[model samples]
Target: MSKVYSTQELIEILAQERRSCMNGQRLNLAASVSGNPVIDRFLKPEGIQKFSAYNDFKAAVHSYQRQHQVSGIIWCELTMKGKTLRYPAIDEQLAALDSDLKILKAAKADLLEFWYTGIQGMDLYLSINFGKDYQKIMPNDVKEVAQKTEWANLYEYKNYNFWEIILQLGWGKPEEASYKRGWPKSGSEYIHAVNPGKCPIC
Candidate 1:
């Protein structure tokens, strides 16, 4: 069975995972599942849709931290059980991710791609394929946010290797999608080829 997470719980999990990666741990997308719903959800293509350049994302987080009295920025949405839950509204407090791919590109990162997610929604996943010699430094806001998860308790998903993780999880139906695939359960399969909402992995 899959574990569920409250919004706050999920954010902490994501922060932990990001910190682990930042500390020089490698995550093999094809074989890793943190076994936590929110972290797993953020691992998907949908989460990656929201973005700006890393620096821009950090700036937004800093601005939000000051004006809103929050610690930093991350993708945020409502979720019930292991599925992403969203209300029909635009969260202006959140960073605008619509132009993130372009912004990340302007920063000179390579390997830019985006996937469509209903209406005008899209996510950014900058590969930063420069390898370790050119690894981008983890933004201070991100470090600050993750460090203060208990206080900030906010995070958002943005596209980055999310699409690839989706591909690794396989597609079509639960039976095939879950077999020998990275996804741990069949119930998490995306049930629709179109009109997939925030949770593509169900």
Candidate 2:
């Protein structure tokens, strides 16, 4: 006879497996900031003018890591008012970038994943696997789980990759018209149109 496990038990088991699989891969704590000067100004400290220098930003991130005991950081760039803006101040950006790199070095993890998205219609996606986690949770497995879940719809892009679908669908975007209605359990198979909001993964 086969052993039976309750839903909670199964969930716990999966969580444990995920944690073990994620071992040495680093945590997923990330920071997302808007590129708008107005937003940046609002976030600035009172009285002391000028946005915090990039060096300052690095120090702050380091401080945060020290206090929270988290791994490296994922930096995400966003647009303001539908217009894409270049990351100004290369020196500062590089400083923060270096700080993150140092964190990764200390943690002994591989490269950190950096992500940036243009206007609503323009998006980019990339998949990152660390340690042996990929073996347990493949892209197809994620698709299958998403198919079994429900979520909301936002928008769809022509180029849909595993990471892109995961991010957008996680945010409640509706699957594109071209997407199929089945979950892929393995990379060998394919899913047609997928419904974002209803994706079983997110």
Candidate 3:
């Protein structure tokens, strides 16, 4: 059976892997190896000798990862690009994510969910199916409200943020929406937000 891990759990696993990578930088090989051939192979003197002098083993490992495109995750399924569909549970979460993405899109943003998980914390704001369909989503009342007023802390409403965008440059808060009721607001703001240094490079 396949294991289902939460995103937070996966993040913790990644952090543990990072700590192990850091520890591997010391290259502390064991004094003795078990009789197992696999263990012996790795414990070979020549194998140790090759990496003995490289203090930055983590960097070398990262370089190897880059060279081979090894993402490390062992996916159980075979490759099936556009043919694959998300699980129902995953689809729900993705829809929620898309709702947040749409809010950011409304404000011309490059921000991700990491900045603000949701209005009341994580997964607290889930106003899925904003409108009748994907093509014409977002209620006219909310859109009209957004157009007339500059709403800040949108994530507080389980929406996304665009305070860092150029349209919001003069805006005091970093969580304000860049647009007021319409798309683009202006290409100039888009340009400023996308410039290398103006926005959060992180």
lDDT of 1 by residue, 55-159 (tens): 233354535434444322233343322445322211223222324323322321111011112212322121222211212222232233223211111123335
What is the per-residue lDDT of model 2 for residues 65-175, given as tens digits with 9 covering 90 to 100?
Answer: 445443333333333335432221112111123444344233211111111122223222222231112122334444554454332112222435432222322111111
Candidate 3 on 53-84: residue-level lDDT in tens?
23244344434434444332221211121232
TM-scores, one per candidate? 0.17, 0.16, 0.20
Q: Scored by Cα lDDT, where does model 3 land? A: 0.29
* Stretches > 4 Å off in candidate 1: 1-6, 25-186, 193-202
Displacement of the residue 141 alpha carbon in candidate 1, Å: 46
Q: Which residue runs of candidate 2 sit more than 4 Å off their true CA positions? A: 24-202
Query: Candidate 2: global Cα-lDDT?
Result: 0.30
Q: Which lDDT values do the candidates have, in the order given?
A: 0.29, 0.30, 0.29
Candidate 2 deviation (Cα RMSD): 21.6
Could you tell me the C-alpha RMSD of candidate 1 in Å?
A: 21.2
Model 3 misses residue 178 by how many Å?
21
